[model samples]
Target: MRAIGTIWMVARREVKARFLTKANLVSLGLLLLAVVAGVVVMDYFQNRDTDEPTFTIALAEQTAELRPGLEAAAAGQDTTLDISTMGAAEAEEAVTEDLDAYISGDPAQPEVLVADEVDGQLLGLVTGVAQAHAMGSEVAALGGDPGAVSEAVAQAAPDVRSLAEEDPSGGMFGPAYFVAILSTSVLLFALISTGALIAMGVVEEKTSRVVEILLATIRPASLLAGKILGIGIVGLIQVVLLGGAAIGTMAATDLLADFEIDLTTAMLMIVLWFFLGFAIFALLFGGFAALVSRQEDIGSVTTPLTFLLFVPYYVAMFMVPNNPDTTLTAVLSQIPIFSPFMMPMRSAFDAVSTGELVLSVVLALATIPLLVWVASTVYQRGVLHTGGRMKLSEAFARR
Candidate 1:
């Protein structure tokens, strides 16, 4: 009960303090503006250019007879092929100018001439049309029915198959990757920024000798817990607000309607990881801050931990493309220290297994109490020591 009261007090103080600050307001405003701008940019690009393929073909002598077949083939492939008769010189010039858009040759056995190498889709389309025309000509030469040969060729084309049992939630990797990267970036930046603020708050109070006065009334653990809890709640709030903005924007724009976000699962994971991550890092930062009486010493003590944070970030990056199934990824995903970032990222791609995710969450929860105990011990030992700076080894030993 005492612990609960202390946590509530700290949370209230931190929330009020932060909300009243001009810097915090400015940061929030900028964050909102950036989110809006990002949504607009994404929408603009998504709706911008059309995807329909347009082909301009320059046919050589005798190819005009194949125009009907070529047009039919182009229509089948959802492409617009503009067939024009040209002399060799004119065809060569057009091919040299835009190889991708121009295919040169007789309507029958038309050879594609391009300024450069053609794309596979265009090449395939052109090849299929040429094959159909060739088959028709061969039948005519053999004194067989060309119409029957054409019908047989059309019936022989293979059916396109969809690989997945269910349609993919998102259209493709583009939007999935976008959401994953954007959400991770926002969450990571928010956590690190707010965690640093919590550290600063602790240091400020201690440096001003305000902690000494407060300690006379509150238990050290309560004070520490309160500060961490309060700031953590605020951090969670920001995360929720930002996530809501992103999801709402996506929903409104129909950006990821095909791809289900599993909002409940995502929110649960975000909330869980935010608290666990905040507790672990914020507590460590608070303890580290206490080791230094002056602000200058704060950075030196925290530098090592700061560098450690980047390891999980980079590990998550490498794992994104690896589909979260690699040996290294599996191990890292289960590790509490890396789970928050790693699991969420892998989850975004539907790469994580249910067992792996549950196991990771369990491990992270199990480790939190141990980390909190260690951090609190360090805080208790170093908070009152107005020394130059405390070594990590010494801080632990004294605690």
Candidate 2:
């Protein structure tokens, strides 16, 4: 109970001290504003465009029979192809004279005009239609069944599903990718930003000689724990704010309506990883900050650790597309050092099994105590050593 009180007091103090500062609030406000603006701009662009493509085609006089097949193909794609029945010479003239104008010209004007370039899928449609028309003409010449040829063509028509699903209102590549990217970006920023904040807080207390006074009243371990708990709450608040903003933006734009996201599961994973990731990085950062006597030395001390954090991020990117199911991913997922980033990503894709997820959580939970012990020991030894930057070897060598 006494230890809990000390931790609570430290946490409250850290939250007030950091948040009440002008610099911190200003930075947070700016970041939020930028995020909101970006969301708005992206939404606007995405919503503004129509899905249909415009195509224009000049059909030869003899190719009048091809019109129905072409129309059927274009209809499937929600596109209109302007068909003009004209002589071969007239069709060639229209295309050669002005390609764009000919294609864009009124469909009723002439059948020999050029058409606009449509989507690649529409190219297949055009080919199917032309083939069907050719088959019909050949059947007519051979005195065969035109109905049979038409039936075969209909059977062979491509089964094209919408890139944008109608019922859920989610796009094939858009919402899922957006969620994955947003989650990754948010988690990366949260871990790095909050970890650095913890470092800065530690450095500030040591530099101000405030920690010495606090240490006299409470155990160093207690102080460290309290500081971390307090700062971690602050980090959680920041994440909630950012995450809420993102979710609200998506909801406002009706982007979430069509997409099926396991929000409950995702939120749970996010909160879990946030704390675990924070605990792992914050303690290390705090210890590193203590080793430096001056602010200038802080950057140098944390640089190597920062690089370590980046390694998992890079690996996550590479692994997201490839072997999301391989041994490497399973190994990385279970490793606490990489779980904060890698596990969340694997969860996003629904690639991890229940056993793997449980094992990952257990491993991460086990690592926390070991990390905290090491960080606290380093902090206790290096905090008072103000002569020069303490070497990691020297800190470990001390009792």
Candidate 3:
């Protein structure tokens, strides 16, 4: 019971230091503002009225036969082009004033005039019009059906079949791939950043010799537990706020109406993963921190753990977003440290099963006890040393 009291005292200090700071509140506000701006931009694009370029172009007599062909090409791209006909003088005036481009002269080599560099969409339209007109002219002269030739060319490739029940083209929202990736990445960043803060705080106390006075009454294991619990709670609070802001923004904007992404399930995963991920690192950081007597030495001792954090993060960012289907993805999502970042992301693509996810959570929970034990041992032996950094081998060799 006294041990618990000592731990709570240390934990209270850490929680107060982290969450009660004015800096944390200001950063939270700024992050929320950024999130709102990002959500607005994403919403605008996602809910845009058309997938096509809003274009106005002038057409001439020579290029009139190519209008249908140009529209056909735009249709294939899932974009529509607005086309209008005009005389040579009017085409030049229209393009110069407000239109996208002006088309005149021969259909075989239509002349296009623009105020600046032609847009890629407009370029595709003009080029398709010219090519189709030229081909049709040739087919007509050769006593063949121009319409049939155009149809055959348009469908040169056949559509393939998929055996999977889920949409290969990623259903309406593709399980909200961008949102899933962004959310998981944010969680990872927050976990690492918060854990780093705890480590730096430990180093600060050790360097100032404040830990010695505290250590006289408290068990090292209790101190380690208290620090981990306190900072983790603060981290969880930030996670809740950040995740709530994002989820709220999406819900308010109705940006996810067409998607199958379950926000409740996702948020739960984020909470669980963030806790597990933070616990292992935060405790490890506390342990490694005792190996150093100075703030500068903090980074060197914790470098390997920092790399460990990145492996899951990079994989989650680069690989998982592309669809978490590879054997590597499958294997990593079930592993302890990597699972925290990997599973939440894999869930976004519907790549992981419930059983697999539960197993991952179990593994992470199971790994925590071993880490706590190791970190406590390191803290017990190395916290009293003040000369310089202690070697890991030496720390282990201690009674």
Candidate 4:
């Protein structure tokens, strides 16, 4: 009961130290604003109507007969055009500013004028219209009806069919991909950033001998546990707020309608992964930071762990999306070290089975006790030794 009380006290201190700070408050505010702003911007663009006419062109009187053909070609290709009739000089002037192109010269063989490079779709529309007009003229000369010939040519096209299986997760740019990226990115940021804070806090306390005063009454393991729990609570708050803001903005803007994510399941997975990942990282970081006395040496001791964190993160970001159901991803997602990063992303893609999730969680949970023992041992020995950097073997050695 006393140990538990001591840990709770330590945890409360950490939370007060971090949560009550002006900088943390400002940072939280800015992060929430940025997240909501980003989602709003994406929603605005995603819902914007793009069906309106985007290309404008002016036709001279001579090429005015080509207007109907051009309009027909544009409409057939599902392109919207804002076309106008004007004199050749006026068309040429408008092409430099208000118009995308100016059409003049012969009806069948017209010249297209533009101030800059021609748009591919616009150019294609012009070519198709000119070819059909020239063909119509030839058909008239040949005594066949031009309109009927054009209609016959338009109707002649091969029906195309694809044999590839449709991906339910919507390929690379679908809702699954969006969730995978979002969840993984948030995990990466939370774990790495918060993990560093745990390490730096350890180093700071050790440097200032604050841990000595605190340790007089509390166990080393208890202090470590308390610190991790407190900072973790704060970190979890940041994650939930930022993630919830993004999701809420999406839902409010109707962007969530386009995404097929099971919001409840995804949020649960993310929160679970965050706790698991943070526990593993915080312990390792705290233990390693005890090896060094100064804040400057914290990075050197924790660099390897930081690198370890990125391996699964990069794999999750790059490999998992492309090969969600692959053997490699499956194997990594089951491992304790990699699962924290890999499983959340895989779950987001709906590639993980319930059995797989349960097994992964069990494996990760099983590793925590072993890690706690190791980290507690290292921290217990090294937290008091404050000279040069202590070796891992030295910390593990019994007095």
**Candidate 4, lDDT over the whole model:** 0.86
Candidate that scores best on lDDT: 4
Query: Per-residue lDDT of 270-309 in model 3, one digit per residue for the tens?
Result: 8988888887788888888888988878888677887888
TM-score of each model, paired residue for residue: 0.75, 0.75, 0.74, 0.86
Residue 113 miss distance in model 3 (angstroms): 9.5
Compose the digit string of candidate 1's lDDT tens values, residues 1-399.
Answer: 876887788778988887657887788878877887788778777766434678777665666666687788778877787777777767666777753544445655567777767878777877777787777778898999989878886798788888867635453355556666665666677677776777788788879999999899888888888887777777887888787777777778876665667755666667777777776677777777777788766677567677666678777866665556678888988887788788777777778888997888788788878888888888888888885777667878873
In model 2, residue pairs whose N, Cα or C atoms come closer than 3 Å (at least 3 residues apart or on different chains), thus clashing, are 56-115, 56-116, 84-110, 84-111, 84-112, 85-111, 168-258, 169-258
Q: Write the per-residue lDDT of candidate 2 for residues 1-399, one digit (tens) a residue.
A: 999999899989989986768997898888888777778887777666644666655555555656777777778778877766555546556765544222222222322233554347555665566556566667989999988878886688688888953633143344654565566667778878777877877788888888889889988888888888888888888777777777777677765565677655665677788888888888898877788887877898678778878888778766764566789888987777788888777776667899988888888889988998899999999887776888988999988
How many collisions between residues are there in candidate 2? 8
Q: Which residue pairs collide, candidate 1?
A: 11-230, 63-107, 99-115, 169-258, 169-259, 170-259
| Models, CA RMSD each | 5.1, 5.9, 5.1, 3.2
Q: Give Cα distance to truth, residue 174, candidate 2, Å.
A: 7.1
TM-score of 3: 0.74
Q: What lDDT score is found at residue 347 in candidate 2?
A: 70
C-alpha lDDT of candidate 3 relative to the true structure: 0.81
In order, the Cα lDDT scores of the candidates are 0.74, 0.73, 0.81, 0.86
List model 4 lDDT by residue over 1-399, tens digit each.
Answer: 998998889899989987889999998899889988988887777667434446898888888899888888878777888988888757666887789998888877788899989988898888888899999999999999998999899999999888997666667877777877888788888888788888888999999999999899888999999989989998898889878887788778777685567866777788999999988888998887898999888878778998999899998888888898898889989888889889988887878998999999999999999999999999999999978999999999956
